[model samples]
Target chain A: NAGVTQTPKFRILKIGQSMTLQCAQDMNHNYMYWYRQDPGMGLKLIYYSVGAGITDKGEVPNGYNVSRSTTEDFPLRLELAAPSQTSVYFCASSGPGSNQPQHFGDGTRLSIL
Target chain B: TQLLEQSPQFLSIQEGENLTVYCNSSSVFSSLQWYRQEPGEGPVLLVTVVTGGEVKKLKRLTFQFGDARKDSSLHITAAQPGDTGLYLCAGGPGYSTLTFGKGTMLLVSP
Candidate 1:
């Protein structure tokens, strides 16, 4: 059914480089989010968008930026990637609101050296 | 701050055994969700518990929401190899976004 799809399943970047992690959902969900999961740690929300043209910052949004120009896509941009940013990034989507469960993408494992 | 914490970070048991996983929080949430993630894949929804004192059951899996809505628990009866995975709990923040717990990895061997 092509739930949530993320591109570039794995990547290696040099310190200070920049890249964008792509996320797209066809479920017509109203909420989309970007999160990072480090080893032994839970997922941390980086950014989220409620709908097209609306976005907000989450717990760890310092080095990341997100844009929701379309209802089906939300991409997280990492500016000046650092070694500390090495982690697996996940994208998720949820329906109408408060009580819905989220569906996640497989993830993108990024390693910055 | 991270809002959720899960106990028993890792668990290994024989098939047909029983196990319980916990998720606790200091903040109140309108809803709580459980997700199971296998290696190399994203977390998949297992259940959603809303309202204090709410309990839901799916086959051998039983989920309970704390009476105060600040904690939850998952109990699997007679666990099987298919139940092995990383179990995560997520709470809906204010209106959107979810705060996830550090997950419990369970290994149910045959």
Candidate 2:
């Protein structure tokens, strides 16, 4: 069912470079989230969207931006990549219910040098 | 901000051994969820506990929620290598956002 699909599974970028981590869900969910996980650390929220055309900054939003132009796509953008931004990024989606369990994408391994 | 603290950041046990991991927080949550992640993958949902003092079992794994809804535990009766993963605990504050603990990395060796 391709619950959640993320593009660019792996990428390497030079300092000051920019890139977009693409995420799409076909479940017709209303909620989507972007998170990054450092080695040996828990997932940190970067941004979230409750529905199309709506977005909100999460706990860790520095150096990143997000847009929700459609119900199926929520992309995360790194304006100027830095080494500190190197981590595994995950995208998740959930139904309208606040208590609904989240479905996650495989992840995008990003490295900035 | 709500925070969750997990103990024994890392654990390694032999197969068939018994072990328990804990997730505690000072903030009350409407519900708590447990997820397990393998190398190179996102965390996968294991279970969710809502009612305080509730107990739920998933085969050999048992999950319990504290009476105050601020703590939870995961117990493995007979561990196996397949059970090895990074276990994360998240608390929901009756909203769409969730606060996640650092996580307990488990390695069940054969």
Candidate 3:
């Protein structure tokens, strides 16, 4: 169904390097989110966008930035990659509602060396 | 920030056996969601409970929301190898954001 799509399934970046994670959805959902998952830790929200041109920071937003220039795309940027930022990045989207179910992409496995 | 705690961080059981995992929180939530994640994939939503004291079943899986909206449980009847995965619970505070639990890793061996 191509519900949610993420590019660069795996990537390795050197310390101090920068990169951007791409995420797109075809469901036309209004809510989009970026999360990072560590080994035992659960998914921690980095940022979220309610709609195009509107975004907000989540619980853990340090060292990461997100932009929602279009309704179908939300990209996360890491200005300077750090080892602590190594994680599995997940992108999710949900319809317009207070508690709608989120559909997630496979994920982007990122590593900082 | 609200936190959800999932009990039995790891579980291993034989096929045909039953198991139950718990998700608890001290803060009340407007809704709760259950998701299952595999080895290399993102979580897939299983169910969402919005009302207090509500129960929902999906074939072999049963989900229950606490009367106070601060706790929930997932029971698997006769688990199979295919059911092995990480189970996670997330709490929604009537907004777009959600607080997630660490998760419970389940292994069902045949």
TM-score of each: 0.96, 0.98, 0.98
Cα distance off (Å), candidate 3, residue A92: 0.3
Interface RMSD of each: 1.5, 1.4, 1.3
lDDT of 1 at A36: 92
- Local distance difference test values of all predictions, in order: 0.92, 0.93, 0.95
Clashes of 1: 0
Estimate, for each residue in A9-91, the C-alpha lDDT of model 1 and write its tens digit. 99999999999999999999989989999988989888888999999998889999999999999999999999999999999
Q: Tell me how each candidate scores on DockQ against the true complex.
A: 0.73, 0.69, 0.76
Candidate 3 wrong stretches, greater than 4 Å: none
Query: Model 1: residues >4 Å from true position, as ranges?
Result: none
Instruction: For candidate 3, write residues A1-113 as lDDT tens digits.
Output: 89999999999999999999999999999899999999899999999999999999998899999999999999999998999999999999998654889999999999999
Candidate 2, position B90, lDDT: 91
Provide the lDDT at B2 for model 1.
38
Report how far off residue B28 is in candidate 3 (Å). 0.9
Per-residue C-alpha lDDT of model 2 across residues B76-102, encoded as one tens digit per residue: 999999999999999887776988899
